[model samples]
Target: MTIAAIIVNYGTGKLILDHLIQIREELATVPGSHLYIVDNLSPNGDAALLTEGTTGMDDVTVIGAPRNGGFSYGNNRGFDQAIADGGYDHYYLLNPDAYPRPGCLKALLAFMAEHPKAGLVGSRLEGLDGHIQSSAFRFMSLESEFASAAKLGIFNRLFASKRVARPPQDEAHKTDWVCGASMLLTAEALEKVGLMDEKYFLYFEEVDFQRAIIKAGFEIWYVPSAHAIHLVGQSTDMKDGKQSAGTAPDYWYDSRRYYFEKNHGAAFADKADRAWAWGKRAGGLKSLLKGQGLSSVDRDIAGLEAARKRAAS
Candidate 1:
C-alpha cells in the first residue's frame, strides 16, 4: 500500500533536513511511499532552506505554507495536497524533530492491516536519553483535571481511572488518544473524520482529532513495537517534561480552553476549571506548609487568568 508521510516543519529546518535521509529510507520500506514536508512559514527562512536541501530527492516534496497557521494547518495543507495528487492508502504524521526507529513504519502498517477497526495508531515515543515518553492517554475529565492540578499521590490514586497520561504499554492496546508526533492515520479514517480542526493552532489538535475518530466508531491504538525518537519541545520551544515557569505560551491555554468548551460544553468546562483551581490551592497550601515556594503554581494561575481575559475579549 502506498503511504504519504507528512512532516510539518516550523523553525526546525536543519533538524528535519538532518533526518531526511533516514526518513526517506524508512519510507522506502513500503514501495511507492513519498515524503511531503510542509514548512509553516518559518521565520528563519526554513522553507527555502528545506526546498534547496531536498532538491535531488525524487521522493520528497516540500510545500511552503503562505502563512504560519500552526501544526494542524500545516498538516492539513500536506493532506490536501496528498488528496489532490493521488489519494494514498495511509497518511503518516511525523514531527520535523522526530525520527522513527528501524521497522517503525512497517510495524504500524502491520498493526493497521491486522486491525481494520483501528483508525489511528501511534508509535511509542522515546527521548534522546532512551526513556519512554507518555505516548498514550485517556481523554480529559474533571477527575483528571483535579488530579493533575493537585499533583498529589492520593489524588492520583483516587482518580486513577481518569488520569490523562496512561502508563507505558508493554504491547499493542487500545487508547483514547496517542501522541501526534508519530501517528499513522488510515485514509478511511480521514474520509470519516475529515482533516484536523485548524482552530487549535497548536496543542490539543491531535486529541480533538482522535476523539472524533473514536466518536465516529473507530479505535485508536498504541503500538509499543513501533518506536520513534522525539525531541520533545524542539518544534515549539516548550519543555513539557519539567516543571518550569513560563514554559506554556498563551496559545496553549487558548487551545485548552477551546478543547474543553468545544467538546465538553461551557458549564462542564467551567466546572473543570474550578476543580483545577481548587486543586491548585490545596497543593499550594501543602507546599507552603512544607517550606516550599509556590512560584510555579502561582504563575500557572495567573497564566490561566490572562488567557481567560483574552478569550472573553
Candidate 2:
C-alpha cells in the first residue's frame, strides 16, 4: 500500500462514518491507499455502527479496540497493524472530526516526495466558519503556554477573531510541530522516531513525536495547499461541563511537563514548567476569588504543584 489513513475514533461514530465515506469518494483516485479505523471503545456503543457503516467500502477496515487507549495508543495500534500487513509507505493520522478536502492526501504526499528530509506533513486546517486554525505551531514552551493561557499569543486570535490572519496559503513551510488532526508521516520516519509516546493520554504527544523526528535528522513541514475542515473541540463539547478536580487539568499539566522533561531533562523542565503552571494557577484563582466562575481554578493550580513535587522527588 502507498498510504494507510489511520483514524482513531473515540465516541465520534457518526463523524467517523462520514469521514470514511468522504475518504473513499475523494481519495479513491490515489493508488494503493486504504482507510483504517480504530474505534477507541466509545461509551455510546457506536463502534459497531462505524464498523457496519463502512463494511461495504472496498478500502475501509474497522478494528474495535477492547479499551480506550487514548489518542496516541489508539493510533499506534492502527500503525502497528498496518506495518504488520506490509507494503504501506506512509501513514496518515487523521482525527474523526476532521474532513479532508479533495486532493489533500495527494498534495501532502507530493510535498513529502519532493522533500526527502520531511518526516511529517500537515495540511491547513479551517473550522466550520472558514477561519484558519493554527494547524502548525512552534513547540509549546513556558512562554508559549503563558501566552496561550493568558490569551495573549498568536493562538489567541485563533479563538477570538472570526477570521484570523495567516501566512500566505501557497507556500510549504517548515514548522516545529503540526496538529495531529490531519498529519501524514512517512513509514521511514516512524521507523526512526518509533511511535507516538503513549504517556500522553490526549494532548502534547504530537509535540513529543515531532521533536523526536527533528532530533533524528528529519524535518516537519506544513503544506498550506492541502486543506481539511476540523470541527474543533466537538468531543470535548459533548462532555459534562464540570471539570474533574484531580485529573482534568492534571492530565494536561502532566503531559506538558512530561514532554519537556523527557526531551530537555528533569531540572530544566521542572523550573520552567512549574513556574508557568503556578502562574496560570494564580491567575485562575484570582479569577475565581473575584466572584467569577467556579473555584476549579484552585484545583488546577494544586494539581500542577503536586505534579511538580512528584517530579522533584
Q: Which RMSD values do the candidates have, in order?
A: 1.7, 4.4
- Superposed model 2: Cα runs more than 4 Å off: 152-170, 238-247, 281-296, 309-313
**Candidate 1 lDDT by residue in tens digits, 1-313:** 9899999998899999888878988999999999999999999999999999999888999999999999999999999999998889999999987988889999999999899999999999999899999999999899888888888899999999999999997899999999999999999999999998999888899999999999999999999999999998787777752324444677887888788889988778778778877788878888899999988788777766776677678
Clashing pairs in 2: none
Please provide the root mean square deviation of candidate 2 (C-alpha atoms, Å): 4.4
Q: What C-alpha lDDT values do all the predictions have? A: 0.90, 0.76
For model 2, how does the per-residue alpha-carbon lDDT over 1-313 read when each residue is reduced to its tens digit?
Answer: 3888888888888887766667776568678788888888988977889877877777888888888878888988898888887748888888888878888988888888899999999999998788987777776555544434443334455443222223435678998888888999888999988988888877778888898999999999999999998888675442221243323555666776777788878887876666556556545655666778635555655666676776667
Clashes of 2: 0
